[model samples]
Target: MSITAQLRDSVRLPGGDALVNGFAFESRGDGPRRALLESGHELEVHDLVEVFAGERAPTAVFPLPWPGWGRGVHSVSPDGSFAVFSGQRAVRAVSVGGETLWEYRHGCWGPEIGHAHTGDEQEVCRGLEHGSCRVSDDGRLVWAHVVVEPEDQDWQECWVVLDARDGRELARLPLDSAASGSHHLSHPDGIHMGLCIGMGQDGILLHWARWDGAKLTSWDLNETMDRILTDVHTGLPGFLTVEHYGADLRLHALDGAVLAEEAPEPADDEDPPCWDYGCGFVDADTVIASTVESDEDPDRARHWLLDARTLEIRGAVAYPTGPVDSCVRPLGDGTWLTYDDTSETLNRWIEAAS
Candidate 1:
């Protein structure tokens, strides 16, 4: 099956240095949509959200905390009222007016800070770096991986849930892994979340959790497979998409069961086609997957559409433009968004009318 996407609209990013990979979108009202953009280099970081509506200039611009280069964990609330920034030493909640609502400090990113350090705050750690955090779907809680120090023992790392409205610690769960850092994947249910941790060659760790009002429950699939989660299929309740070690795309249940799997069609004399870690469902029945730039030919990349239930290749997907990055984000509707780093523009793509 062949899939064609029409370019709905393109919004040029504010700063020429916008980090395409760091962009995130949160919808508000019916008029225009807002998205978070991170820019700047090294220690100088500027994070802001730009409202995109037709051809008019941005109606509003909201600033967020500057997340340093290495620690890039941050999220805007769905309602676009607040922003949360998670770094090596702290997680803070800031209001749209730039007020620091509250902050929670934790262990440092490493045993010692790198030369990139510029803040006056002093912190220390046991070499655990690359921490991450995400806001819950309801925008009421923040799930974060942080270091917890005990009075009689050395520091340890754990997952902590905080009240997003005031940054109050609500719950904590100790984690056992070799994860230097991790990323949080939010579920549409507002009660479940997934954490993916990369531990060098040891393999990846998958932590699935459910948060009730009273407690937090979780299960981890420890180094079972070298897979990176691409999309959580909320439509199917327990199903999600994963790129297995960059080799094949697999549909997996929340309990680590492989439901279905498939790889891209390989060319005659060329190398086997691999899927990029960035992929997701365009709807209940259609999945959008992309190819990574080949190491042998860095400029080569392509997109593939697949049957969500059968894992069959429906067809190759073509965009109006020449090439795009591997970061394909689903907008919950049938439409999706892709970023062009070269042009510093965010393009919305929707299936052409039948």
Candidate 2:
């Protein structure tokens, strides 16, 4: 029988799009997630628990650097004391009081690195490429995927771990990638981080790294295939990834081992149903996967509940209230999140009682 999904709670987004990491840090793994997003050069932070419980009226907001290209991706510290933004030319950390704590400037992510450098917050760049950054679970280090100034007419990108307090460069690893965009997945140990870089039609690049105080050791996983790392399990020994073309979902060990994998079969009169890039472990034993992209008709889009460790299909997820959207963010703690565009609300979900 198909598993039923029920709404647990929801909060309407204040404005703009909200980025949620419900299970980001190990310390606050069980609590509701805190959310932050850029809205016209302003960073809005939401205590999701308070908003959902009707305990707080207004969430926190802070001023941020002006972005000529785009806001790019950003992450807040575990304690919500500050935030770091991977910008067009720099990685900046801003305090909760709207103060610029520190900024690390790098080669321009704009079209031409040789462009005039304004050295101002209002400086504009002309490029669509972006890299991502995330605060470590311990809140002491910030791991960033950034592009460096090129040499010999060749582009160079690197992953750098910086001091979260002083913005000092602690460690850096060069990456051979032309990323359109990328994101970081934090390991529970707080010392390891997984980076997935999207290289447009060139394919995806997956890199795993460990920072042990003095050095940064990195490894390239699946050197040939394009897999997008989506989520990590708190209780399991592996992380989740979907093929770049959504061909299958895989559970990968940190040492570059495939623990398990699942792919869908083609139905009658239909092309093979490929998985969407969005998927994750809802619990140690259960995973939530989607195939929204495989369906041409939105009404028939689907999500499934599978055995997390074995890649066996338990059943397709059933919603009593309505059909959920295609994208899912699994918290890996028996819960996941979805958003309703019409209502502008972020909805949390769990298995329904029989």
Predicted structure with the largest TM-score when compared to the true one:
2
For each candidate, what is the lDDT? 0.66, 0.77
Candidate 2: global Cα-lDDT? 0.77
**What are the per-residue Cα lDDT tens digits for candidate 2 across 1-354?**
678998898877744123433222222344446666556767777676676786544356767766454646688888778888888878989887878899987766665746777667677777788888898888899988888876675568999999999789999888888888888888765567889998999899998888888888989985656899887766876678889899888887878788888896456888889987778878888888888777988777788989988888888888876676547777666787776767877778898877
Residue by residue across 1-354, what tens digits does model 1's lDDT show? Answer: 657888876677654222324434433212123455544321112222232354434332445454233454676676656677776678877776777788998766564534444564533333546677787777788988887777875677888999987888999888775566677777665677878777777677778888788988888766566677556654765555565457778888778788888888787888887776667777778888777554355356677888887789988777666655446766546767676666767676888876
**Which 10 residues in a row give candidate 2 its minimum summed lDDT?**
19-28
Clashing pairs in 2: none
Off by over 4 Å in 2: 14-32, 55-59, 67-69, 150-154
